[model samples]
Target: MPQRLIASVLLGHYLSAFTTLGIPLYLPRILADLAPDAPGWSIGVLFILPTLCTALAAPLWGHLADRHGCRLSLLRAHAGLCAGFLLAGFSPNLTVFVLALMIQGTFGGAMAASNAYLATQLKDGNLSRALNWTQYSARLAMISGPILLGLLTASGMGLELYRVLAWLPLLAFVLILPLPADAPRRQARTSDGDGDEWPDQLPNDLPRLLAVQFLFSFAMVVTFPYFVPYGEALGVGNDALIGLLYSLPHLVYLVALPWAQRQAANLLLPGLGLLALTNALQFWSDQPDLLFTLRLLSGAGMLLGFVGLHRCLSQRSRNGSAGRLFGWYDSSGKWAGAAAGVTAGLVSQSCGIASPFLVAGLVAFAALVLARPLLIAPREITA
Candidate 1:
């Protein structure tokens, strides 16, 4: 596998996360000027809606890629995302801002398509490691975007940061021009054809895996958007400190992800336990330091869980439904994210920030309990 292709895929991931996150972090600032009616929690709700749109759109893109080629679908998705960011950067009205976010999100399945592309291009044993490295790019972008936006805020010229963020997607459009699409390895094959029976190729474990994805993703996305507010509630209200608190998990995740990738299915329970502990800390702690440490542990859990999940699914790619499986995974994950975001935001608004964390932590703990059956079941391998 050429490093350039991996680099290109990572570039897309980086830009997508960078721009998507800038909107949320800067929402507090943007709303301060335009939509004073929008409370911070409302802004959080607004931020998650786009991901809801992405969740809705993932399957369409995935299905299209299954019939067409992932390369073409990816190119079109990127082109649309660039346009979406441009609209978001210039939106003068809250309604328009929401619309732009949806557009950007609708095209968000490009990441799934890109994942399919990489799975097709890389050999099986190397797939999990490659996915981790690709994921690191997005994680890096998530960490960088907020820190830079925080600096821009301190300098008092942060309103223009959206424009800066928009440039990344625009540059991505330009950069994607030269990459070759993954050649179709199963073009003439059909699930109905004896030569390529699709159902026979489908992973029997999909239903259980999808359930696992929903649980883990729901816990993750829901907990994530609330971290900043959680810190503020704990009396660490500084923007930079809030950003640092949010960044802590990714910092820890980067350290754990690569190792988990190498360990594969063997890492599942430890990963689930990490998630359980993260929630446990939230259930008990009120101090900033203690909560931050817990958040880091939660991130470690996510790293382990995701590496295991993706590794497990990537194994199914050779079954001839890789694109469809991944599309379902992305869609399921995003929907869970969307639900978590809205529920967590509303819960925080109605009760308190800490309420959502404690509640969602409990949900995550339950998810870990349910994950055991699937991880232990022996069935099929596909990647």
Candidate 2:
């Protein structure tokens, strides 16, 4: 890929990730502003509603991208996201805020669109590397966004920060406008003496892959919404520290990517096992240092397992249905995340905040079992 295209994709990923992950950093404050008397579980509800919408919208966007064009899909998604944030910033009550989130989810197919677009541009080994780089951009945003929000919150500017941040995506939309247009690739598959291959359907392994995605999303979401409050309960109350804890895994994930990509096949089982172990260990630690270390280890596991899984999926792309394929993949995860949010809230309400981590660990173990049959020695991709 040309450097200019790479830059554009990175910028898009950064803004998207920032806008999405950044909100959760100040979610408590946002809720307090919108509904001063709202119960704690409302946080989970707020996150759940938008994700459910995204899940429903994803496949439609994918199908549209394949039928129409990815450039148009990209423009529509970014514009919708910009409007959603603006509406959210101006919301006067929890009801209006929830509606705004629904709008955001309805329009937010940029990640899937972006992935499909890139798949058309790069092939084989180059494709996997580009995907990893895109993920790296998102992980980088996951780190910087919270830290920036933490600083703003500590400086007494948190109240108006979300409104200010709403404009960032509009800038991203402008950045996207100059990129080359992408048309659908719908060429029929040709036989090469081996037999026939259908272009319209997903790979045979996709069902199992979707199941893995669901389990992965379920595990992550169960612990995510409660991380900040969990840290507060453990006596780390600084906004910056809380943000660091939230981002620690991704930070370590950035460091582990190259190794993970290289050792993907060898690392899958161990990585998932480590993830389960780390999540389970959370139950035994209240110390900030110990928790941070655990999160860092979790990042390594994520890089190994998810990077490998995504590479396998990308390699299976056929026909012109990359958009539709990835859309379904993304949708599965979001749906799982939505369910996990509600379940996590219920569990936390009846049990304790720390209990979700254990549940998440158990779920990760199940994912490990499902992943075993799918793990193949990845062929080295050369640029």
Candidate 3:
């Protein structure tokens, strides 16, 4: 792959993740400004609507990329993000802001399109490395984007911060424009001579892989929303310290990316096992230091499992189907995260915050058992 293409893809991935992940950091402020008396239920709706819309739109965008071209698909997503941010930043009412976010989701398939574009540019071995790099970039953004936005808001930017940040995706759109155009891969015709379309049936292994993706997502998110509260309960009430605890895993994940990529094939079981152990152990400790250590290990475990799964998926996908396949994979993880969030909220409310970790651990363990064959079996492209 050309260095320029790699740079463009990584930058685009970073910007997309930065904008999306940073929203949560400023969500309360945004909500307060838009609807001072907004109901608690509206909070969930605002967050979930874009996610659900993205999940629904991803595969369609992938198919469009497969039929049209990756560059155009990516440009469209970026354009939409730019418009969405502008609309969100300037909206006089909550309804308009939310509708803009929904519009963003409708065109928000940048990550999927980037993956597909990279798939076309790199062969299998290099593809794994590229995917890991892209993931690392996104993770880095997720860690830093919120901090950056928060700092700006603290310095008196307030909601104006959104208008400032809106320029990023627009810049990304310009950056991608100079890259070489990506042509859609020609598809083989059906027996009855039907026109080109996405494959009617996915590989048998795909469902199992998606299941693992869901479990990994569920396990991680089950404990995500409660981290601040969990830390406060342990007597670490400082916001900075709590934020550090939450970010420790991602920091470790960035550090562990290269090793995870190198050991991708053999990582699934061990990684899942480590995640299970860490999550389960969370139930036994409220000490800040121990929890930090557990989170660090959990981060390492998650990096291994996640990179391993993507490597496997990339290797297994047929040439023309990469976009659609990754789209499904991305959608599966998003939906799983959404489900975990809701379920964890309920479980935490009823049984205490610690209970979600226990449940997440069990789910990870079950996924490990169920995914054993697929993980250990020889890699082959399936129809």
lDDT of 3 by residue, 1-383 (tens): 38878888899878877887887667777788789999977887777777788888888887777677677888888888888888888888888888888987777767777777787667677777788787788789989898788778787665566677778888888888888875564642232135333332245678788888889888988888887787888888799888888888789889977767776255878889999999999877877778778889989888877777767776665546667777888888778878988998899999887888898899999888977877566654445
lDDT of 1 by residue, 46-127 (tens): 6677778888888777777766666666776777677776777688878887787788888755668667767766756666
lDDT (tens digit, per residue) of candidate 2 on 223-291: 987888888888887977887777777887788778677753546667778888899998668777788
Which candidate achieves the best lDDT against the true structure? 3
**Residue pairs in steric clash, candidate 3?**
none
In model 2, what lDDT does residue 254 have?
86
In candidate 3, position 43 carries an lDDT of 80
Candidate 3's C-alpha lDDT?
Answer: 0.78
The C-alpha stretches of model 3 lying farther than 4 A from their native spots are 187-202, 378-383
Pick by TM-score: which candidate is best?
3
How far out, in Å, is residue 380 in model 3?
Answer: 5.2
Model 1: ten consecutive residues of lowest lDDT: 191-200
Give me the displacement of residue 63 in model 2, in angstroms: 1.1
